[model samples]
Target: MDIIVTIFSTIIDQLQKPTLAFLIGGMLLASLGSKLEVPEPVYKFIVMLLLLKVGLGAGISVRDANLTELLVPAAGAAIVGVLIVLLGSRTLARWKGVSKIDGLATAGLFGAVSASTLAAGMAVLDDENIAYEGFIGALYPFMDIAALVTAIVMAKVSVARRASNAEIAADGTMAMNAAPKTEPAQIEGLEKGLVKTILVDTFRSPAISALLIGLAIGIFAAPDSVYDSFYEPLFRGLLSILMLIMGMEAWARLSELRKVAHAYILYGIAAPLVHGMLGFGVGLIAHHLTGFSAGGVVLLSIMAASSSDISGPPTMRGALPEANPSAYVGTSTGLGTPVAILSIPLFMALAAAFIG
Candidate 1:
């Protein structure tokens, strides 16, 4: 009974907060046709600051963390990433009759992590005074890369199989311009090169780089250094403003999302919930294994619920050129994010009750 009351109280508290009020205000304004938007450069700067702040905060706490405790959860994150792609892709392909490439690409987009959403989750944790380990940021890139690579590989393999079957039907004569055949040795070399390129690109992502740099500084820099001065004052304010921008961006995309098929809408809404629940399960396991508090469970579940707006789409475009960009982008940014924002807290509450 107290759990129910607590959850309800949390919801009410979230609704009444100034930060969420700003986010809601931005959405209402955009929906009412106000042309308000944060300038692109300003938005970019805010994002950089938020990422750096998160990284620094994580680094500061990481000194006392058991690094070994992260190994299982990290591995679990990869497994869950692959599972999300498979589950989401199959549902889209089978139920919605979406093309294999498009379905798989959409899955990848939703399967990958979102740094911004993670930031929001962190804000919630802070407001509630929830305790969580800081090193979870280190697990982000791994999960992000895993989901993307799985989706790409699935799409490629599906294409190759179809091409091979068609060729076999045509008496072993490959059609012109129908996926060029390469020698086995060339294929092996290309595979190695692709892996290297992906690693380079993944680590080079702004969010991941910031996290890594922060981790380094946190591990090596002395406590109470000047680094403490910058992040402490501005973190919450920047995040609030960023959420307002996010609300505007989400509203702006609503028209585009409406143009998509109803089936796509259903898929978009359903996919993230599925991922969130599964993520909640994974968070529970991690909590038990690592002694994560209720807050950490929620944050972990939030990480699982997030779909990539930054890294997933570009990787999908490069790997699955024939994929429908509209579907992928709409689902990830327009649908998945909103669902995640609303539902992640509920998942957290659930985690709190169970763990308590």
Candidate 2:
């Protein structure tokens, strides 16, 4: 009972923060049918700046981090990413009225990191004076790419297996009782340079590119003066704007989500909480192994909870062309983001309860 009260109190406190308040305010405005909208170019610029700041901080920390400490949590992040998608494959993908392709696409987005959400989580942690490892931001790309590649690969494999079965049936090459076999050539073709393709596409994405550039500059150059004077101070203000934009956009996408399968709506609402807990469990293991901080655990859970809004949709569109965009994009931007943001304090509270 005390834990529950603490959780609720933490959530209420977090909700009052300007970053989240701006988000709720935007949602209210959009719900009221306001024509207020941030210009696309300006929104993109905000995202770039925020991501660069995160990357720069992480890079600076990584410059002196013990490699074992860094790699262990990173491996945990990668595992969590893969696990989220695979878990969705067994549950959401197999649910009635949900197409496998759409489910996997949605899973991919949920598993991938949200740059804006990450920035928001960092802002909230700062506001609450929760200390986390700077290298936490460096785990972003590992989880993002792993989830994406895993989902796309799984989707392609499923499609190939279906095609193979169809061909076997048409040619009467396999008995009804026997399993249909995909040709070696077909299997080879399905995976041919697939990982390489996804890595290229992910790196080429503007969000990831901005982050990587910031990381490289931080590691290679002496930009501490500019970082301290420029990025650090502006971080919160920029994050508030980003949160506002996300809230308005999430509210706007609600109609699209409504048009999809009802199962998707349920999954979107539940996935963040479930996936976040999974991440928290992984973080606990990391903590035991490397003395990872409670705040780092909360951030990891936040990353798992967040559905990718920037790079995921485009990557899904390119990689899984047959998947319905309305299902993945709408579910993610509409329901998942808000739930993830709202659940931040719950995870933080849990971290406090368990780790303290």
Best by lDDT: 2
**Could you tally the backbone clashes for each prediction?**
0, 0
What is the C-alpha lDDT profile of model 2 across 89-199, one tens digit per residue?
A: 999899998989899999999999998888899989998899999988899998999999999999988888777777777766464543423554566898999889998
In candidate 1, what are the lDDT values of residues 8-88, reduced to their tens digit? 877777766655666677788888889776888998788777777676666677777787677767787788788998997
Task: Name the runs in model 2 displaced over 4 angstroms.
Answer: 173-182
Candidate 2: residue pairs that collide = none
The number of the candidate with the highest TM-score is 2
lDDT of each: 0.74, 0.92
Q: TM-scores across all candidates? A: 0.88, 0.97
